[model samples]
Target: MIRVVVADDQALIRTGFITILDSQDDLEVVGEAGDGKSAVEVAQRLRPDVIVMDVRMPVMDGIEATRRLAGAGVPDPLKVLVVTTFNLDEYVYEALRAGAAGFLLKDASPQQLIAGVRTVARGESLLAPEVTRRLIGRYAARLRPADPAVTAESALTPRELEVLRLIAAGQSNAEIAATLVIGAETVKTYVSRILTKLNLRDRVQAVVYAYRTGLVSPND
Candidate 1:
């Protein structure tokens, strides 16, 4: 079973999410929290496979909670799936930067929510291509300027660089394979290598890294 913790300030919302997630055969709501601080506490103690976090809460807020649970330098970082009522660019950007494995609008359907949890639980990003382009592109200019010392060329081979670009562009392995005229397994290998070389956690971080390093741009 994929254990999950649902965190939200609203009791109704928390119960609703718990109900839906528990309904899934593969998912179980092991814990629930009403505020960001409690969410962090419960998650740290329980160490669920996935956390369904709310962006705005009374005590800390989901972004900070995510950072506490999954931020860089965290040993054995947990996978976080941020759920927010707002689709604002800043929230999405900050959540991803805080090491959330996925972001989903609260307005998303139950199936979408379930799928988001499963996607994060499986160690994959839940960002759809259009959503990624729209959210990350809008915030591209706000990202810190690329560090001159860390260039993609220095870390990745020519083909690996190409794969990273496609990944940042929000292409799936199958899509990338088709785009590069390569096999899916080859693309997967390239992705694994890119992550290892860059010391990135997953595709979401890779996208952030690509933008932070000026590798793949909003215009690209």
Candidate 2:
């Protein structure tokens, strides 16, 4: 079963999520928290496979909670899915930077929300090109990248760079395989190598890297 913890300040929202998740035989609502602090505590105690965290809470917002949990490195690398009321790019970027596995809009359909949890639970990230570009405009506009152009010469092999570009473009493993004329497993391997080479937390961060490095730009 995919154990999950729902963290939201609102009791109704938390209960709704619990109901939806619990109905799925594959998912379980292991715990719930009213704030980020409690979120961290419940996550530690339950060691859930996925955590649905609300961005705005009374004490210790989701961002800090995610950061703290990441810093703790507890529960064998928890997968945090930031569920926010706002679609502000900054929130998404900050959540990803804080080691969250993915970003999900609060208004997303119940199926989408459940899918997001399942996606991250499988150790994969869910991010699209639009999401990546918007986050760049929101959080990366002021930041400076070490290099404007991160070429294959830097560290990534040509094949790996191709994979990174596709990832940045929001292509799935199957799509990437079709594009590169390789097996999906090969693309998965390339993705793993790319993350390791770039010292990134996940593909979502890799998309950020592409934007920051100008390998893929806001306009592109």
Best by lDDT: 1
Against the true structure, candidate 1 has what lDDT? 0.88
Model 2 is weakest, by summed lDDT over 10 consecutive residues, at 144-153
lDDT of each: 0.88, 0.80
Q: Residue 204 in model 1: shift from native, Å? A: 0.7
Cα lDDT, model 2, residue 90:
65
TM-score of each: 0.93, 0.84
lDDT tens per residue, model 2, 1-220: 9999999999999999999999998999989999999999999888899999998888799988998776335446788988865545567677776778778777889998889989989988877455555564456545576463434449898888878877877677888999989998888899898888777778877876776776765455
Residue pairs clashing in model 1 are none
In model 2, which runs have C-alpha deviations exceeding 4 angstroms? Answer: 71-75, 85-87, 128-130, 146-152, 178-183
What digit string (tens of lDDT, one per residue) describes model 1 on residues 1-220?
9999999999998999999999989999999999999999999999999999999899899999999999988899999999875445578888999999978888889999999999899998887776777787668658786674557899889999999888888788899999999999999899899888888888898888888888878888
lDDT, residue 2, candidate 2: 98
